[model samples]
Target: MVKGYNYIVNSFFDYLENRSKAVDSLLCVGLDPHIQHLDKPSAAAARDFCLEIVDSCAKYACAFKPNSAFFEVFGAEGISALREVISSIPEDIPVILDAKRGDISSTALAYSNAVFQHLGADAVTYSPYLGSDSVAPFVRRPEKGVFILCKTSNPGSNDVQILESNREQIYLHVARQSLVWSKHNNIGLVVGATDPYALTRVRDIAPNSWILCPGVGVQGASLKDALISGLRKDGMGVLITVSRAISGESDRAAVAAELCDAINRERESRKQNHTVHVTNNIAVDLIETGCVQFGDFTLKSGQQSPFYIDMRRLASFPDVLNRVSKEIVKKVLDLRFNCIAAIPYAGLPIGTAVSLLLNKPLIYPRRETKEYGTKSSIEGVYKSGETAIVLDDLISTGGSKFETINSLQKVGLNINDIVVLIDRQQGGRKLLDSQGYRLHAVYTISELIDEWLAFELIDNNQFILIKNYLSESA
Candidate 1:
C-alpha cells in the first residue's frame, strides 16, 4: 500500500506493465467479432470467437478492450454473449469495456453498474460533455475507473472535437475538463493516435493522465508519430491501442504480439519527450477519490446550500485520497503551520494523509474527549505555541468553525488558517475572515452549482432554488 492503498501498484501502471508482460509473451488480440467474420452467425458464436481470441491472446496481450456496440447489435442475446465473453477471458489480463456512455444520475448509475458488475469490466469509457453527474457513479465505486473521450481516432471526431474556440481546439476543452474530473476519479483521456497535435494538446492539459490511444494499427496512425506525440516524461502514460490491423489477420495471437512489440518500439522512440505543466493533476485526482461531492444538502446553520462536501469518503478510496492529499500538500507547500488538526472524523483522514505526506506532525480534535487514556479531546502529536490549520470537509455558517478552532487553541495551538474542502459560501468564508482566520477552499458550493447549471445537469428551478436559499441565508 503505497501511502494508503490495498493495491501495491497503481491500476494504470499495472495495466501498462501487464501489457508489456503480455507483449513479451507475444499477444494483443482485438475481440471485434463482427457478425460477418463469425462462422456460426450467432451472438453465442461471436462470444465464443471473442473468448477464443482472448484464450489465444491472453498469453500474448496484457489487456483486452471490448467495443460494446459489436455485441449490442444482438439485443439480449448479444448482451449475454458480451457478459460471457468478458468472464471467459483470463482474470490476469484486465478488460476495458469500451462503452462510450454519458448520461445523468440515475441513468448513469445503471450504465455504470451494467459495465462494472454485469459486464465485469475493470474500467469503462465515458463522455464528459454531460457534466460531473454523468461520471460520478463509476468513480464512487473503489475498484472501477472511467476513461474520458478527449479526442478520438475516428476522422469524423474532428467535426466537433477539433473546432476552434478561444484559439483552443474543442478537444482541448474536453482535455482540460477531463483533468478536473480526473482529480476525483481515476480519469484518463482517450486521444486518438491519428492526430498528433490534438494528442499533444491533451497531454499538455493532463501530463500525468494515462492516455488510452487508439488508431495505432488499422487507422494508419504511425507508431513513430504516436511515440513522438503520446509518450509522457515517465514513458508509461500512453496506452497505444490497436484493433483491426492485428485482429483482422490470421494467427491472431502472433498479430497481438506484433502489435505489442510495435507499441513498445513507439514507446522507446518517444522516451525523451518531456512532460508539461500538470499543476492540477493531483488536485483533480483528489476530487475523484469520492472525497469530493457536489450536490444540494442542508447545512448546520439551517441554510440550504448549493453543494455538500465530504472528504472522509477518501478513506475508502486510496487513489483519490492519495491524489487529493498530495495536491493539498502541493497547494500548501510554502505555508507553515505548527500543527495539523481535523474537524473530528470527517476531516481526520485528509488531515492525517497530509500530515504524513508532508512529514508534518498531526493533531485532530474530537467532537468530545474520550473518557479513558489522556482523557484528551485532541489526538496524535500536538504541541504548545504552534500555529495550526483547522481542517474540515465543509464549512457553512462558521458556527462549528469557532468550536473547532477553540478546541485547538485550548491545547495551546494558534488558530488562523482554515483549510476546508468545500466552502458553502453562506457566511462561512466571511465569518472566518471576520475572525481573522484565512479561509482556503478547494471549491465553493456556488462554483459547483454553476458547473451543474452550465452542463444542464440540473434544472433551472433547482438552480434558482439553490441561489434563493444562499441569498436568503446570507
Candidate 2:
C-alpha cells in the first residue's frame, strides 16, 4: 500500500489498487476462450486455453476478466471449468467475471453468490436496466465490486444509450445513478474505449469511480485516446481490457508486456496534462461565474479585503456548479468518512452536489436551532461515533468552521478532516491542524491567482495586490 493512503482492503476496488501498484500495471487481461481459438469445442479445451493465458499474462495483469458466456456454453462441464479457471488465477490479482448479470433482488442475490462465493471472483459486470433493486444484492457485500453497464462498445449502443431523458442522455443518467447506488463504495461504470467523448463525460460525472474500458484492439479503439479521456488525476482509475489482441498473438506474454508499457507511458502523460488543465479551467470558471471577485468588501469575519469569494453564486449556474463539485469530489475521494457535514448557508448546495455524486450522506449544522418544532441543531440523519468530513466554500481564519465542528461534536459525531474548494492561505489550515483536524483544498488563493495571471484573466497589478494581501494576512 502507498503511504498516506487508507489502504484497508475492504472493497474489490481497494484490492485492485493494491495489485495495480504492486505490478505497476493497469492492464486487465481478458480471458475469452472462443471456439476457434480452442483445440476443440469442449469444456476441457476452453479451460486449458484460459489457463494458458492466465499463466503467461498474470505477471502483467492487474486483473483477469473471463467472459462467462464462453464457459457456460458447455453446460455443467463448462461451468466446472469456469470455476477451475477462476481459482487457478493468482490470489493477489483480482478477477472480474464478465457476466453482466441483473434481475430482481432474490435472483440477483443468487447471481452474487455464484460469482463471489461459489466461483471466488472478486468483481462482476452487471446490467442496470432493472434499476437499483437489481444492483442491491451485488453491492451489499462491501468486499466485492460491481461495474454497471453504461455506454457499451457495441455499435447499437447509441440507439438506446444516447436517448434523452429529462434533457440528459441515458448513459449520463446511468453514470449519475451509479454514484447513488454506490453507498458501499464498491460500484464502478463500464464505459467503452471506442467512444472517447462518452468516456470523458462519464469521467466528469464520476471522477473518483473506477472505469472498465473495453473495445481497444478488436474494436479498433485507440488505447491512448481512452487513457487521455478516462484516466483520473492520480492516473489509476481506468482498467483497459484487451482480449484477442493478446490471445490471438503468438507470444501472449510479449504482447501483454507491450500493452502494459504503452498504457504506463500514456498514463504518465495524461496525469501531467490533466492536472494543469483542471486547475486552469477551474480558475477561469470561478472568475467567470462571479465566484471570485475583486473589490473592497467586508467579509463575514469583519475583515477588510481586496477581493471576495462568493461560492453561493454557484447555485445560479448549474454547469459551473457541477464542474466545481466534480473537482471537490476528487479531493474527497481518499478521505475516510461515513458522511459529510456541510457548513450552513454557503456549503449547503455544494455539499448536496458532492453528496449525490459520491453517494455519501449529507448533514448540516444549522446556524441556530429553531424555537419551534424538532429544534435539532443538526439537520440530517446521523448516528453517534460516526466520522464526518466537513465541507465549506473557503476557509479564512477558521472561526466559523469551529462553530459547526463544535455543534457536530456535541451530538457525538467525530470530525477529523475538512475539505473546501479554496483555501485563503491564511491561518485556517494551521488552526485546524492545531486542533487535530486536517484541511484539504482543491486550490489555494495563491495558486488561483497565479493561474489567473498566467492566463491573462487578471492584470499583473491585481495579482501583485492579492499576493501582498495574502502575505500581509499571513
Candidate 3:
C-alpha cells in the first residue's frame, strides 16, 4: 500500500483538498480503458493503456476515477488490472472507484471490502436509491470516502431526479439527505456538470461538501459554467471529471495540462468577479424579507431602539432562510461539535436550517418544559458529555444565551461555542468569552449597517442611529 494511505484514509477529503492545492487543479482524470480504443480487447492492453495515462498525467491530476465496469468486463484479470492501476497512482492523489454499487447492508459490506480493501480505492461512488441501510457499510469506515449519485449527467436523469417531494426536487432531497448521512464528514455528492441548474441547486443546499462533476469535455458540459455554478465560496469544492476528452487524446499529458490551466483561469476569473461579500448578500436578503426594520421599536429587554431585527421572518422566506443557512454552515464547518442546540423562539428555524445543511443533529431548550409526557428540559435526542454548539438568530447582551446554556449544562451537555447570524456588539462576545465559550458570527451589526448604507438601502440618519445604538450598547 502507498505510505500513509491507511493513516490518511480517515480524512480523504482533506487529503484530496491538499492534493488539489498542491497541483493547483480540480481536474479528476477518468481512466476508462474502452475496448474499442485499446490496441487489443484484453486485460493487459487495458492495464497498459491506463498506466500510460497515469504516468503522463499524474502531475496534473487532482484525483483519478476509473470506471469499474470497463475493467470488470474482463472478469478476474480485469479486476487485477484495476488493482494495479490504483496501486500505481501517486500517494497524494485520491482514487475514486465509480462502481455505483447499491445493495442491502450485508451485501454492501462485501462490496465495500472488494473496492476499498481488494482494489484499494480511496473513495467509491454508489447509488443511494436503496436508502441509508444500503449505504451504511461504506460510510461506516470514516476513513474511506463515499459519493452518493445525486443529479447525474445523463439526459434521462430528469425523469426521476426532478420529481418533487414536499415541493422540492428529488435530487435536492438527496442533496439534503446527503448532509444527514455525512455525519462522519466523509460523504460527498456526484453531480453531473451537464446540468448547471442542478449543480447550482445542489451547491446551494450543500455549500461545503465536495461535488464530483462529470461531463465536462466530450459530454459537452462547459467547464467554466460548471465552476461558476458549482464552486464553493473558497473555490475548491468542485472537481471536474473528464474521461474520453483527456484519455482519447494522442498527447494526453498536454491535454491534461491545458485543461488544468483552463480550470485555474476560470477559478481566478470567478474569484475576481465575485465582488459581493457573502454577508452583503445576506444583508440584502434580510432587507427584502423584512427581517431588518428601521424606525422606532421597543427591544425585548424593554429598551427603545431605532430598529429591530426580527430573524423569525426568515422562516417565511425559504430562499432567504436557505441562503443564510449556507453562510452559517461555512462558519460551523471548522468547529468541533456533537450536535446543534438552537435557542428557542427565533432560533429554531435558523437552527433547523443549519442543522439540515450541516447534517448535525439538532436539539433545543424549550421556553417552558411541558408538564405532560417526558417533561424533558431539552428537546431532541442527545447523550451526556457531548459537545453542543449553540445557534441563534442574533446575539445582543448575551443574557438570553445563558438561559439556554444553563438548561443544556443541566443535562450534562458541554457548551464551548456559539454561532449566530449577527452580533449586536453589546458585550455579547465578551460575556461569552468570560464564561469559557467562544462566539462566531457571520456579520457584526456595524457591518450590516455599513452594507445597508453602501447599498443605499438605508438613509444616513438610519445608519447613524443604528451605529450610535450599537456604540452606546457596546
Worst 10 residues of 1 by lDDT: 269-278
- lDDT-based ranking: 2, 3, 1
Backbone clashes for every candidate come to 15, 0, 2
Question: What lDDT tens digits, residue by residue, belong to model 3 across residues 1-474?
Answer: 233345544466877887898889999999999999999999989999999999999999999999899899999999999999999998789999999999996788999999899999989999999988888888876768999999999999999999999999999999999888756878999999888767877887898999999999998988866886688878799999998999899999999999999999988765654555655388888988899988889887898888889988889999889888999999999999999999878889999999998889999998999899999989999999999999999999899899999999999999999999999899999999998999999999887876675555775446555755776778
Q: Which stretches in model 1 have alpha-carbon errors above 4 Å?
A: 1-29, 182-185, 269-474
Residue runs of model 2 more than 4 Å from their true location after superposition? 1-8, 272-474
Ranked by TM-score, the better of candidates 1 and 3 is 3
RMSD in order of candidates: 21.1, 22.1, 22.0
In model 3, which regions exceed 4 Å deviation? 1-10, 275-474
lDDT of each: 0.71, 0.89, 0.88
Candidate 2, residues 1-474, lDDT tens digits: the string is 311235556677888888899999999999999999999999999999999999999999999999999999999999999999999998788899999999996788999999998988889999999999989999987878999999999999999999999999999999999999967879999999988778878888999999999999999998976886677768889999999999999899999999999999887654554356545388899888898899788977688898989988989988888888999999988989999999878899999999999999999998889888998999999999999999999998887799999999999999999999999989999999998999999999988886775455765456656766888998
Winner of 1 and 2 under lDDT: 2
The TM-scores, one per candidate, come to 0.53, 0.58, 0.59
